[model samples]
Every structure is written in structure tokens, then in C-alpha cells.
Target: MTLKHLIGLVRALTVFVLMVGLASAANAVEKNYTVQSPDGVTIAVQEGGNPDGRPIVFIHGLLGSRLNWEEQTSSPQLQQYRLITYDLRGHGQSGKPDEVEAYRDGRRWADDLAVVLKASDAKKPVVVGWSLGGVVLSNYLAAYGDAMIGGIVYVDGVIELNAALIAPHPEVYAGLASDDLKTHLDAVRTFIALCFQTQPDPAIFERLLSNAAMASWVMTKTVPSMTVAVADSLPKTKVPVLLLYGGKDNLVMTGPSIARAQELNPSLQSKIYPDSGHAPFLEEAPRFNQDLSDFRNSIQARK
Candidate 1:
């Protein structure tokens, strides 16, 4: 090669190397934080990635922690987004405060989220909630619906949690009403098996058990109230919503539930992973990440 061409090549390679180095440096510094709720529950959170990128917050279900969304937080598609995930007040690394009243409604839970966002100085974030996490998100939007939030992604969750709870179907109702964690889990597994058309995984069951055993009195209060509230007001969430469900979800009756949810809010957009059940993020991480990325891009593009 001519000396001129070689010099040009060196400069181009140097620029590429610098860009990669900057990205690597940015990826290395994932920060973790803790925020105290109004009721004194210290919730754990982790924040990192492009500080100027769109903020995306993930909320887990009844018996889960921020750890459940670890894949989303670390995803390359999410690298350009400021990702945040946290444990509910009584679950995961968060403080388990006793008393059902503390968890009765999603108001305090919303406050907890607001505090965390403010503490981190994050912009209006697009919140992705799963199962009970979706309940909390709906409640947050219902009570504090505003432009502060860019969008909502209900991952196997909905605006009317209580409606799902009260839906007629002796078998499903019987399954949801069980107070025994073991029995509830069996029902969950059975439901999963039915929906997925396959045997349920023992590892998933064990994780559910671990999450259940840690539940506080507060977590229990969240169930009935959240159920009723959503039943009463499922159609009001007008924010951009994406309902992603697992066709194999055992606890949630997919067809009827999604149909009813869409009926309540005509603006609701949805997608279902046929081969997966309740935990799509865990069961199909790559596809889940891609779908989420595409959704986020669409949201960003609109603005």
C-alpha cells in the first residue's frame, strides 16, 4: 500500500479503537443505590448505562426481585438506555416491613418509584411491569397519570388486576384463591403446563417458592385491594401501553384476560410469546430483548 493510504488507515483504526474504548468504559460503571419509601422501606436499585439515554424502569411480580430483570439491564439493546430495576418493598433485597396496610395500595409503591427516580435524577422513564408489577404500574398511572412517564409496558400484567382475580371460571378462581403457597405454586405449575403444552420446570417452581417464603404481611394486602381497584378502573390508562403476555402463563388466562384488558382500554397494544409462559424474559431472553428494543425505539421515534 502507498504511504498515504497506510496513514489514512491508521487514523481510521484509531478512531474506531477510541469509540470502542469509550463504550467499554461506559459499560463498566453500573451503579447501585437504595431509596427509602414513605413508610420507611429501604428499596434497592441499580442505575447505569448512557446517562443521557432514555430511562427504562422494570418492576417484578408478587414473588420476585430486581434480579429477575438482570438480563434486561445488561442487554446491548438496552445499553443506550438508562435502565433501572428494583425490588418491591417486601421482596428481594428491599426491607420487608410488616403490616398489610403498608402494602394495601400502589400509592406508596408509586412514591417509592418517584423517589428513586428523583434520587437518581433520571428523566421520565418508560416503566415495564410484570404480573403484580403491572398492577402497581397501573395504579401508579391511574392515580398519578401524567406526562412524566413516556410509556408503559405491561409484561403479562394489566390495568385491571382485580378483574382477573374475579373472573368467572370455577377452576381458575379456585386456583387463585388458594392461600397455601405450596398449593398456589402447584396451581401455577399446572396452569403453566396447560398453557405451554409442556411440563413445567422445577427450577422456576423453586424460585417461586423462595420468593413466596419471603413475603411479608404487606405483600398480602396488595392482592385484594389491587385486584378490586383494577377491576373498577381497567379502562382508564390512556398512556402508550404494550401488553406482552406468555401464551403459557398458567395463572393468567391468556385469551380471556387479554381480550378483556383490550376491551377496557382500546389503546392497548399487545404481543404474546406462544412457546413461553409467565417468565418470557427468562425463558426467551434474546427475543424479549429485541422486542423491548423495538418497542423502545418506536416510542422514541414518535417523540
Candidate 2:
């Protein structure tokens, strides 16, 4: 071939490759950052979907991280809204402070959430808190009130550490606090299994178990006694609140937990996933996502 023709052909191929790269970049919709909490813990944050759309912040349960919301984060049906999730102070890639105060203080957890919210620049975002995350939300309400949030969703949330609202699993709890690696690992397995009444796909469960294993051992031992101000917080929240529970939850008591929350806020709304357990967001994601979208829209309509 002539040199000129060879050069032209190579240029054309280069242009084609550049176009493909641009197309791939356009298809990617997620970004990540780290936020420093007031007490200096580094919290990892991730954002996905439409950047300018209304925001929905998801707070995962105990021993979980941003990985817990993959179902919601990757959904095409719910991609219209901006989705934000983060690793709690002691879990996943976030900083794991050795001090008991960092893990056991409700205000510290609340501060971590506050830093994430500020970092996201989410305006009145719908906050979805699951399990231990619900306790963080209650603490946030107690510390900061409802002025910054659009709505709240508590999914099989822990309102308090009260035995009346928590299903008894004494051996499991003690095992979790045990210093022996075998005992703690077994307890983590048992606790995770209890989160799902219908077993998740084996691969999904494995990934979640790995996530749990990454958590700080000190955090697990200290967090059970973490103070929660639900009694003072939920009743005083002016924003719309939702209680989304798994009817068959093996961890938190569904009816009693809901009743306790409702007693505090008479206007609280609730829904139950009859066949699911602690992790309804994972067990029944499509329905949970739809319910979440509808709840956010309802809140917007009222504003």
C-alpha cells in the first residue's frame, strides 16, 4: 500500500477507537469519594444514576456497606433518581477507629451520617435506613432533626435494643462478642442467615458474608450496646416516616417494632413483606424499589 493511504487508514482506526472509548465513558454512571466525619473517620461514599435527579440515600444494616444496595443501584427502572450509599464508620472500606467511643456512641454514628449527607450535597434527600442504620437515623433525628431530609424509610429497622422489639438470639449475640475467631465467624454466619427467610442466591450470600467479615471486630462487640434515641427522635420528626418490615423477620420483631414506632409517631406509615426476613431490600428488591420510588414521589407531591 502507498504510505499516504496507510497513514490515512491508521488515522481512521484511531478515530474509531476514540469514539468507542467515549461511548464507554458515557455508559458509566457511577462515581466515588471519601468524606471525613467530625471525629476524623474516613467514610467512603458512592453515587450513581442521574446526577441531577432527586436523591435517595440508602443506609445499609449492620456489617454491610455500599455493596448492599447493588439491586437498587444497578436497576434500570429506578435509575431516574440519583442514588447515594456509603460505608458506615466501621464497615467495608471506611475507617475503623479502635476507640470504643467511636463505635458505641450514637452521636458518632449520627455524625458519620451527617458528614455523608453534607458531602453528597443532597437536598432533602429520601433517607432509607435498614437494621442498625435505622438506629443511626434515629440518632440523626435526635442530633439534627428533620429539617434536612425529605422523608425516611425504616426497613426492618432497629428502633431500640429492647428485648420486646428484638427477637432473642442470646447465644448468637454472645458468640458475636466472643474473642475466639471461630465463635465470632460462626455468629456472623448465623446472623447473616437470619437476615433472609428465603435464602439469597449462593453467590450473593457469599459476597455479603465477605462484606461482613471485613467489619471491625471491635465495632461488632461494641455496637450492640450503642445508644439509640428513638423515643426522643421518632416522635419529634416532622418529616414523613415509613416502617417497611419483613413480616417473618428473624432479627427484629415486626409487629411490636412497628407498634412501638407508631406509638411515637401516630402519622407513621408501614408496609410488610410477608415472605421476607430482615433484609427485605435484598429478598424482594423490585417491590422494595417501587415502594421506595412511590414514597419519594408522594413526598415530592406534598411539597
* Best of the candidates, TM-score: 2
Summarize candidate 1's per-residue lDDT along 34-68 as a digit string, tens digits.
98887888989887667778888899886677766
Residue 123 error, candidate 1, Å? 2.1
Which ranges in model 1 have alpha carbons more than 4 Å from their true place? 1-22, 163-213, 217-228, 231-234
Each model's RMSD to truth, in Å?
Answer: 4.5, 4.9
| C-alpha local distance difference test of each model | 0.71, 0.92
Give every collision pair in model 2. Answer: none
Kindly provide the TM-score of model 1 when superposed on the true structure, using C-alpha atoms: 0.78
The prediction achieving the highest lDDT against the true structure is 2
Evaluated at residue 257, the lDDT of candidate 1 is 64
Over the stretch 45-113, how does candidate 2's per-residue lDDT look in tens digits? Answer: 999977877899999989998899999988876777889999998999999999998988899999988
Model 2 CA RMSD to the hidden true structure, in angstroms: 4.9
Per-candidate TM-score against the hidden true structure: 0.78, 0.91
Cα deviation of 204, candidate 2, in Å: 0.4
